[model samples]
Target: MNVSIPTLEQFREESRAGRLAGRVRLQLPCNLTDFPAEIFSLADSLEILDLSGNALSRLPDRLPELRKLKILFCSDNHFTELPRVLGQCKNLSMIGFRNNRITHIAPEALPPLLRWLILTGNQLSALPSELGHRPYLQKLMVAGNRLQALPQELSLCKNLELLRIAANRFDVLPEVLFKLPRLSWLSYSGNPFCSHNEQTALADTPVKQIPWSSLSLQQKLGEGASGVIYQAVWQSVTPIPVAVKLFKGELTSDGLPISEMAACMRAGIHPNLIKVLGKIGDHPEGVNGLVMSLVDASYRNLAGPPSFASCTRDVYDDDLRLSFSEMLSIVSGIAGVAQQVHANGIMHGDLYAHNILLGQNGDALLGDFGAACFKPTAAAHSHALEKIEVRAFGYLLEELLERYEGEATAGATFATLTHLTALRDACLHIDPTQRPVFTEVVARIRTA
Candidate 1:
């Protein structure tokens, strides 16, 4: 949450240095119309350059001079097109231009070694096939765009693990997308593929609707890309403290807030899932909200979100290690929740470690339905979609194994770990049909 924004004075000081010990990071927020020419002086060692929150329209043509530059952030800028000079940066791997007016991306604008690319909230309707050439590309975020279809060549990005193509105009799911080997996390909601009637059908369901006037908002608990969560006390005959999520009520990178609310309501109650108390109604600001049980303070995020280097995969602290039993308990709980949610004709599209909460004893609760989608149970592809999420679970299991690092291998523990490894492999098979369903996964883990 805390971003370090450098000042012009710091860059001047580094410029004064004879380039031997020049600063490697130059982050400035000054509003300007052009790139500073002096920045090229430290091109030898510059690694990260943040020119976000500026009025720049294009980058300098000689950007490739920065031989060591790796990360570039130019979000919240004025631009009608992505600067083609970006593709010339040999060492650049990460490019972020979120919340821009970019509508066109030149065919040569994508760096060859690109690993993580973020172009959220843009006006792009199409992308060039050159994007498919980036062999190392992993995380691609293009949500909130005007895209109607994805470039078929993008399927060549075999390493892509996480993708966000939601809030677009696509009429159907891209078949090539399902062929990716490492696609574990995805969000394609709010497109033509989603039906508004799925939520309209629940209009008269037997669920309580709590008015906003009867609740007293308290301290904030957490927040995500979709909404902000706060602690609140619902005043009834007997007052009760609960968690309230007041949505921003805007089209997020995933989808509309209403769709998320419908998915949460449909999820209902499960032991390993957050219990929805009711829906907030009659708000003063007309903001959409939800009421849910307040989780205990002991619960913490299981792992951190993906980093720039580990794109599309969760990152964990080196010291964080769970016991064999604890890891099994957490995985089993999540698998059970997956089975229950899929049974209710719902797909938890954004299943990742960061969205999971873990108690001290490693009991897991799956939360966050922003990327969830409601699918018809009789739909032909419903089963296939469920298998795709099983791949996400396999990815989580792999991350847990990496964190453990074979440090807790006792007699029985080692045997259990071996079985878990096989299970993960089976779930991560290249062909979706080869993967076992959540019900089978739960049964296998229970017997192990």
Candidate 2:
């Protein structure tokens, strides 16, 4: 599935020779300071254009010539402002300006059909109120910015499903966020409102400190926005094998690495959650890390990350099917873990199926704290935060039911489906106050 990238010279030569006429995608990143005029040769068919990792400050005014361009990425650039001409690209639905120097976005900078917008790691202090006018907008990632508040107009984005406003200057949680009906995933840690509580919780949590000298690193298991996980051997009395997550020491779309580490440490232990053994100490590179129990090889991710079309929802294999029991077990395990996490005053902000792992017998393990945050101290605010996550769990249940292969009109299966449907509706109640807490959700599942 890997398409070979063309070198700058090759691309130039192909375009000059009229050989790139029908190409649908183009990725040329060679430190160019200006948009390649040659790209215009494929204007008739190009749908995706990636100009990331470049030194350009502005895109060509004729960018709208590519009438078919649906996605555009201009990350890691020196753009001081979003190009105003992008609004002319009527077909553009997704735009990424991550890790850019953009400090301003004109009211007309966004395209009409925009659905997903990524402006993470920018210096913006405010956003255009025009953002709320985009009826198709679903995912908005503005983490690591300097914004003090979100425009109340954004509450009109009724279809917004995922949002990341972490590491901002907000003094309080935005009241408008509670009004979004489809906000299933959210991460707002590292802000002034709840930072003190996070530090206090981290200090109160007790954990062992494992030194780097006693560990031998092995192959890399996986990498997330905050850290790289590796399969390492802990040179303890018995030389145990464990997974070590080394923090990247940078701001991610979710938030700071330190926040994620604190949340993981505070999570403690749960039967259906990944076991954190201890924290890493005296690293050779002075990197922050955690030591966790290595998960079994038989366990695999239950689903893939969200795709362009799926927006905020996880993408499952089209042919994958699950029996009624298997689906129920996965849901039950996640519900139990969520109940325990909430009781500890933590919100697993990114509680989608992609963060869950499933074993051969349908046993589930919920991992990844990159988007988690501590709850507010106020009782009402804390309850509302848990309910926001309840909506995420409700989406998880909805996704599983779509692939359920069991009969819905027969005996126990029929009754179970009906009960689960009602529970999902309750969890997804538009009124956050009306939604049941994880404790109630777990009880209902157990009885069903």
Return the TM-score for each candidate structure.
Answer: 0.92, 0.97
Q: What is the C-alpha lDDT of each candidate?
A: 0.83, 0.90
Q: Give the lDDT of residue 283 in candidate 2.
A: 88
- Top TM-score hit: 2
The regions of model 1 sitting more than 4 angstroms off are 1-21, 201-205, 376-379, 403-414
Worst 10 residues of 1 by lDDT: 1-10
Candidate 2 structure quality by residue, lDDT tens digits, 240-276 = 9999999998999989888888998888788888999
Q: List the residue pairs that clash in candidate 1.
A: none
Clashing residue pairs in all predictions, respectively, total 0, 0
State the weakest 10-residue window (summed lDDT) of model 2.
1-10
TM-score of 2: 0.97
